[model samples]
Target chain A: MTEWEMVVGLEVHCELATATKLFCACPNAFGDEPNTNVCPVCLGLPGSLPVLNRHAVELAMRVGLALHCSVEPSIFHRKNYFYPDMPKDYQISQYDEPLNVGGRLDLPDGTRVGVTRAHLEEDTGKTTHVGGGGGRIHGADHSLVDYNRAGVPLVEIVSEPDIRSAEQAKAYVNELRAILVAIGASDARMEEGSLRIDANVSMRRAGAEVYGTRAEIKNLNSVRSLGRALEYEVRRQVGRLEAGEAVVQETRHWNEDEGRTSSMRSKEEAYDYRYFPEPDLVALAPSAEWLAGVRAVLPVLPSERRVDLARVAGVAETDAAVAAVVQQGLDGLVTAAVGAGADGRLALNRAANELAHATPPDAGAFAKVLRMEADGRLTATQAKGVLAELVSAGGDPEAIAAAKGFEALEGDVVAGAVDAAIAAHPGEWERYAGGEAKLAGFFVGKVMAATAGKADGKAVTALLRERLAGR
Target chain B: MALISRDDVAHVARLARLDLTEAELDQFAGQLAAVLEHAADVAALDTAGVPPTAHPFELVNVLRDDVAGPCLDRDEVLAMAPAAEDGRFRVPRILGEAP
Candidate 1:
């Protein structure tokens, strides 16, 4: 049997976070009353012209810089097509001269995906097929058009066909989303349709160098859908090849509910978008000074934040816990805690697991709690309780601990409890003293109960081992 | 010889949803051929250093701030539409999904 490999490329469309539409003053907002945001330019009325928005270009350039792309002089072209969603019967987009030419994104797993181009374009309006069953256009009576989303500025980032697996595709999208949010480019929310993905997938023999006919999958709403769609499409192509059938090149729609991809259209039906330079707008040649200004303001990206956190926390950069903390933007809190003399591993564990749920607390206050745990003033259980309170209600960590009676039990009291636990569990104690290391947990549980969960498990283990060695 | 054939004209008319008569397709093909010949004459010039022009003006980066202004009245806009329902423009049954 011949092994097969899947080759994938992605095109991600991210809506720019701008106050106005791309070419007009109409508000660039989502979910406004139908047609409420329409202006003459956006509505494609006669004698209306489009003026490029400066901030939109800057935001698009920021994305390019974050992805390590070179910003170049570009111009817009009218991608002519006949679709009701685009009131102008065409879309203004970057064609031959795109803004950002070559870039690359490094995923958390150290996979560097090459980006081909990220260009500026205007978004089309939304259409709802009302009279069809399930709102599909197949059987619909008529379609209703909403121009609220029309003329919104978008940056379509096209990636090279470097992704070889479904997991890489998902990772590429995740890292791209993080970069977008970090650079204040877009919200990057898949659910809100702010960020959209279309994948081109093909299956070839594992060792073959040449490419195979590819199918482009659309309507992947989330990262999970992108993965599933690629997997399904690859399997379907492999099945066809095994049965002596050639894989037809086409555009497939990913049905999330059905978990399969169905043919939408083929290459023969593809629209010939007669692209011509948009004459209404002038060429965009951003000065070198302005490019430097955008580069200066780019924030610390997620990958750097993960590496920094992992370095300070003494964990591997590929650690799942490290990724979680960085994804939730809690790495700063963990780093600050480590800087305040708290144990690195403990601070990271707590921040990734517990702090992820609650509102972020002051870094200093959080570090103080971990410091108490490290100094044996509070057990792990008691320290967790204190951290919870610190997150919920703001106060000095010591005061919160003392008011909750989490002051460590006197040494004598702990000793007494340890003695009582040994006495109560003679069989377990004898086995433990006789070098049954697993019996240590039994004694720790008893001491914890006796001290009302205040006793530190680590301290209990230490005392047990010492006593056993002495015996 | 004409640069554009009648069949080419027919194809473009179909794409644009224009129901042109057979005679019109032939007429427009000849007319479009003349226009292409003129463009070809210009393309034949040898001005090696001259850059291609996209617009008449020499201006670049003509831009506006990202501030929104007032929108047109939705009611008046919808009133002009041939069909309007539920605060949106109602068009005939779309042939296929948007590309």
Candidate 2:
């Protein structure tokens, strides 16, 4: 009902894609039988020492650099808290020294979101509250806990209240997800609970000097939910301010179904989580050489890849944006395609729009198919076919295309198909003669379909025009 | 004196759903107090222009080739659920309905 300025910040917890847990040999995996993938180290059993997974640290470093963060030479800490989900009772997390500090991520809207800190921590187990006949945990019989995910490597990236709107929050997550994927750090899958987001939302009157009290939205799993939660919280705060009431400091639950945020509990102001130097692990100062090595392997950021694809690949902005959306390195995809003798522009189109469209939901796998197509052995059409095959039957694009008799056609055979198609389609031939120039697309389609896309598209287009002109 | 009192420890323990005894509560109060006291030095660092660290690693994305593969079997993933009344995972009555 009233105008307000929303101030938003985010704490994003992304699970690193390392084979082992952050501090244990237990596999860092989901979909495993509960407790099957866990061990004494992850269970926080006594006498179990923690071992730092170097790969996780490298991934954290890689992510920091992609976000333009100044990677510290060293960082480590402990966050103390007792919970049923945490086997150790205290989570081994960075308090003062984190993997990355002070970074900025550019959104497509041309806004830069400031990153406050990205630190590494082990994940706690999952808890399921059981309530009895009353249907509430207040008088519940007991609770169920699953420790399979405990001690999993996690990097918490905190943003400096730079976000303004729900869209901005969503954009931040998307961009961050892109960067994480580029670095091969984490899967960044929200549904599998590999990536989680918590938001701090506060609103002040249009002219208010100091910021309003903030409410923290706990345990938001998806970027869309993160955006919706922030939007609802901002309105709720503004309503309170208009009614001559102050925004209460508390933790809230995002009722996604209701599209609103409800207070869960009064917020805790700096209650001490007894953080200490983890005695099991010492200060791990990353060497500059180690960082340089990681840098060499660093995939280009989505934004930089977009520009590179636009320039070298000569792709349109919309096409480049599609590749950026999947966070697949545009240059890499283009290079691979060109190596396979496919044109850069053609590869970009297939990678960005065509493959992106057919991917349906698995953006990760779609990007992979685009890469395979770039190698030139598979036609874009065949790549699409492989994508469909992958969607149904389980096989690589080359293997699938090869089995389906959809390999790319080379020189003479492609030329032969072009000649044959022009000779066959005559009525459409009359349409092209009448200055219906768009009919060229129809001929190209017919030739390509007849040849099964084995012919070079450019060669077909050029030959079709020459023959049509003679007619 | 520990900065984390029994009341504070108990309250946080309750929030996180940790059922601790009086003896463990007192022990945690002392341990937590010691830990926070050590962290007090974080304020002393002169960060005038120094940005707060968020991520220590580089920001490059590790991309997967856009190809689909077999994902976890639904039954295999959900088999170890503490409570499974149906195809979906079930737990004690939840604190609040999913949003």
- Best candidate per lDDT, number? 1
TM-score of chain A of each: 0.92, 0.70
Tens digit per residue, CA lDDT, model 2, B1-99 = 566789988987875678999899989999999899889767788879986543454432222222222333445645645555334345444443222
Q: What is candidate 2's lDDT per residue for A244-363, written digit by digit as tens?
A: 998888888776777887777776444456556665565666678888998899866677766655666565544535445345444565555556555566556655554444434244
Alpha carbon lDDT of residue B38, candidate 2?
88
Top model by DockQ, which number? 1
Superposed Cα RMSD, model 2? 11.4
For model 2, the superposed segments whose C-alpha errors exceed 4 Å read A132-139, A207-209, A312-355, A359-471, B1-99
Per-candidate clashes come to 0, 51
* Candidate with the greatest TM-score versus the true structure: 1
Model 1 segments more than 4 A misplaced: A268-271, A410-426, A429-437, A463-471, B5-7, B20-30
Lowest lDDT block of 10, candidate 1 chain B? B90-99
Q: For model 1, how does the per-residue alpha-carbon lDDT over A399-444 read when each residue is reduced to its tens digit?
A: 9999998988888888889989998889888888777888889999
Q: What DockQ was computed for model 2? A: 0.07
Q: What DockQ does every candidate get?
A: 0.81, 0.07
Real contacts retained, model 1: 0.88
